[model samples]
Target: MSILLIDSYDSFTYNLRHLVENATGAHVLTIHNDSYDLPREKESLNKLVGSVDAIVIGPGPGNPDSAQDVGIIPYLFETFPKTPILGICLGFQCLCLAHGCTLGYLEHPVHGQISRITPIDRNSLFRDFDTDFDSVRYHSIYISTVTDDIIPLAYSEDQCLMAAKHAQNLHFGVQYHPESVCSEMGSKLVSNFWALVEKRETVPIRDSHLLQTEPLIKHFKTTLEYDYKYEKIPKVDILSACERFPDPLLLNSALSPGEWSIIGLPEPGRSLVVGNSREAGLTVGTWKGETKAHSDSLWSYICNHMSQRYYEPTIGDPELAKCPFVGGFIGFLSYEESIPLTVNKITSGPTPSTRLCFVERFIVSNDKHTFVVSIRPRDKEWIQQTKSQLQTCSEPRFLSSVKAKVEKPDKKSYEKSFYDCQKYLHAGDSYELCLTRQTKVHVPKTVAPWELYKCMVKNNPSPYSCYLDFGDARLLSTSPERFLSWNNQLSQMRPIKGTVKKHPQLTYARACELLKIPKEIGENLMIVDLIRHDLYQMLKEVEVTKLMSVEEYQTVYQLVSVIEGRLQDSIYTGIDLLRHSLPPGSMTGAPKKRSVEILCHLEDRIPRGLYSGVCGYWSVNNHADWSVIIRSLFNYEDDLCSTGTTRCFRCGAGGAITVLSTCEGEWDELNLKLDSVLGIFS
Candidate 1:
């Protein structure tokens, strides 16, 4: 049997797809009804209905009547009257209305509420259903009148017609979501519906969504569950120890360019790095399972999941006043979802483009001269072994064998892409599109990433810098642009949008003059507005702490903006804040959503992987920060490598192309932005 699930886009649509597929083992195809008709000539109405044996309309907000013109549901019922049909929530109201019933607004709408369901008729559909069961109902509209052709099968506590089976055909409508995990009887209800479908072909019964690595909220009221202490280790010692073992994962950050650092080292084969929230503790290359392609929803789940976990905590000595979540999620997401703002996903780049991570042992720095080692109560041995490793640091390791052989994009190709971005800007599809390109580097295995990281910091350092080895790949990021930062203590975001590369010949006045170009200012304003909207999702009143301000970096000066909002609610965690602001605005362009869609289409729909994503840490104190994945070295193993030692490394850069953007100008900006990374190779 096949089931065609028409997605009306509820927050749980992804969950719905999984439930229906796992429950029936049916071939299920879900399409966003709103865009199903895109490219109408190719996806004609007939082509969509050719393979399905049944149509299941999933739940979504909004009235069914309002969606009549966007979907083929009404026509499908008219053409395939006998095909098994099921309507869930909005879907139910939709099919019900098509069958000639009138709908009414609920006196009081219930969203995410558990309500009693009393089956009024012992229809075969309710064979195993309890006389009164619980189900989740979230709706503002209800079936006010059931025409003679429709028989009400169930009612809510308020006597609302919650479920009805069409008397004339195999059509069934249920206003309550049987698939919600919150409802105890949801699964049985769904199963029963499936059973009915089988008996009639069939008989049936029915219904129904982070990274929960550690507890999201800090336990300040509860006694400190862990203890801490610090050590004054020589830099040579820590560096020497890390060199001895190249097999373990390393996440290191510096207090300054080359001195003082906090490094988190996880035992080999025991811990991992994650990019997608769905896969926790699984390193980059080992992830074979599917992830939520829906970027927005995926982020929400990741934040909620990570915040709620009670991961063992690592206590710091004297505790750095900033207690970041000792061990939690880290990594980047590919902005490849076919969101409304972007074109559909049509690219198949096999790179594990999304990576997130969880850390266990942390070696932190309180002062540049002093450091602390934090781990769970039982991880004393691991901590000691780490310290012991750092103890052997007098000699330097020979890591660089060959320089990165960089391959730049064809000038014309990039110019063409820049023009492509402008086309969208002119079309109003996006106000400021971050169009990026990368240089492919054929790297030697002996050219160690850690060594390159050292060079990057020495040559060009930033406020947010990180170096991580994810087994399959290593990331050395030194980004001045902070995508988002949250202090369970406070909520704010620092986004970098404008740019002006610095040079010996350029005076401070001249640099500031170039940064003040009208186009740069306009681009910054467009992104600031979009970012303010993002912050507004969590905060009722977001404030622009800084605007059109210039922040100088080692290689360039950026037009930076600071926006903050109150996180008065303690229920939110760093994860929650990130979800509302992933694939940072500066990278996505103004009108973030549509711009992503536009870029996807222009980039051949290939996943940006870590190129435009984020790299950062959730602090032990419940604060977190991530750098935009720009001006970073991204490397990974390749099967195409004829030599085992051959690897692929990339340094990426892009600029926001506004209507005022010229191909030559965007191309030059990209080159200047990436000079920090590509220059290190020279």
Candidate 2:
């Protein structure tokens, strides 16, 4: 069963979706009340009303008396008598008029203020409630005379009826908007409505809409009874302390045959899956089973360390191109029986060490997988040097070894298939089209693995950066600006886009000075402008909460800014925002779609996969936190290897420009970025 919310305005829909879904787990569809230009006919109203189990008249602007003349109200009362109906605010006034009640206009309507609600009688809708409670009131029209058949369920202390139920039909109305945060008993009202719709067997109705006399007291008692103690268990160590590991880049090539299956690991009992079409992309387990914090918080924790460790140092000495350390981390929650896994930090282990850190786990579904990752020093220096050394010791692996199979359609048939897919998109069947194209790039030996690694290390501003030395296969690496993530009402976005190269004459301090140039600021602003525009489409008036500023990173100083926007009324799912604003503008140049097209034409591949894709979790409440997957490697089972062993390694790199970027400079920068992952090879 589903509930259709009609004419609902912004963010209000978000709260309503949450309320209804949580109470009954029913599908909720929201339709903009004004967006539809339906002919005011009884048949039109019936058709709209017939599509759902219940029609909730959502809160919106305009006088309630005006809506009655428009024909929706009269049609509802005259035609659909059996269908359950609900009205909030203006919706309530319309309901009263439709039920033969008179709407009396107030000289001055009190808006957005608290009022005392007094219960009139015992009913299932307000089954369990106290005699009185406070709720938000925002209406100018009052139901002066209710019909004989309608029973008054609740009224304000001033004698204005706040809630009424039809004795003859499954119809209800509330003058007070129950969807607002100010509605003290709003959630209970929704729950009661669900019970009625779901036809749950009930014993008897009680007076009052508020259930518990003191819900806060019960909550405190419940909190105190909860236990946090756990028994210490034996930890499992990796088989060998210093096994000669294969190239991290080769890991994906080795494990490609598995096609990224999700599996529950034994020791930690966490689900693990690796294999995204892109070398660094992710289709891993869901993040819902992990921590409760927002995604931006996690990104801030990681990026803050990256800025201090890698960018700051690189800015001081540009020649120091190699920082042989890099790692990835994931935070999540699993089953109660699953134990948290801890790996050695390698603070003083091998010459070049890296670690990925997993914070804490949260929730896991019966069929879903959950796991967290951690990589240490979380600085750019270690990441760059590690990759440089790793590359010097290894050979470039071919693409065929790791590339997933692509089935091409015949030329004549491909167009038809493409159009069908396009039709699906236009009809809102899918948000994105995932397709593949073959491409290649020349790998010059001048920028050897270590040389390139050093260049990137010297140039990078974050302590934690990534490098992908795909060799002739065409390199794709990324240094990301971890964007916004949210769980429920909380949401955030971090934007970073500014760069300065290390020249022989430029000292680390000089490089930081260079980053403050106006041209660089313009570039950063362009991306910010684009991001704000994209956000505005699905969000409310977005504010540049954090102005553009230069923050010191490991190797250099970076120009960073924070942009914030409130989610729209209809946008309830985190995935919805992701689908609309993906391949972050900071990473992709301004005019995102055009930038992508230009990259596709100039670069070697389409569908960069997880390399530029996001990884994170979406919780039960539709809140999510995801990160752009950079400075990471993929592992997979290799059937072609003589030893039949699985391969594992990481990939990293940066974006490009056709006009301003020279071939040699671009090539050098690419090498610099790859040094982090390559350093691990040596």
Error of 1 at 115 (Å): 53
* lDDT, candidates in the order shown: 0.62, 0.42
Model 2, residue 79: displacement in angstroms? 42
Task: Kindly list the per-residue Cα lDDT of model 2 for residues 1-682, writing each as its tens digit.
Answer: 6676655332233444555666666655655554334464435444555656776766544455564323254455556778787777666777777768887755434444467887777566687886678876555567889898778889887888898877888778888756544467777887787778744223222212111111111110111211111111121111110011221221111011111111111113242212122112222232222322223322233333222322111212221112111111222211100112222221121111111232121111111221111122343443344334323433332121122212222333333433443343232122222222211212232323333333333333232233322221212222334565653344566776555544467675776577655445544554555566555445544566665666644333456777766654434333345545666655555334434543443333323333455444332223444545444432212211112232222243453332222334434444444443343332
Model 1 TM: 0.61
lDDT of 1: 0.62
Candidates in order: C-alpha RMSD to true structure = 15.7, 19.6
Residue 574 C-alpha lDDT in model 1: 54
> Model 2 Cα RMSD, Å?
19.6
Local accuracy of candidate 1 as per-residue lDDT tens digits, 60-138: 5445676442265666667777777788887788777887899776554554456888988766567766568877665
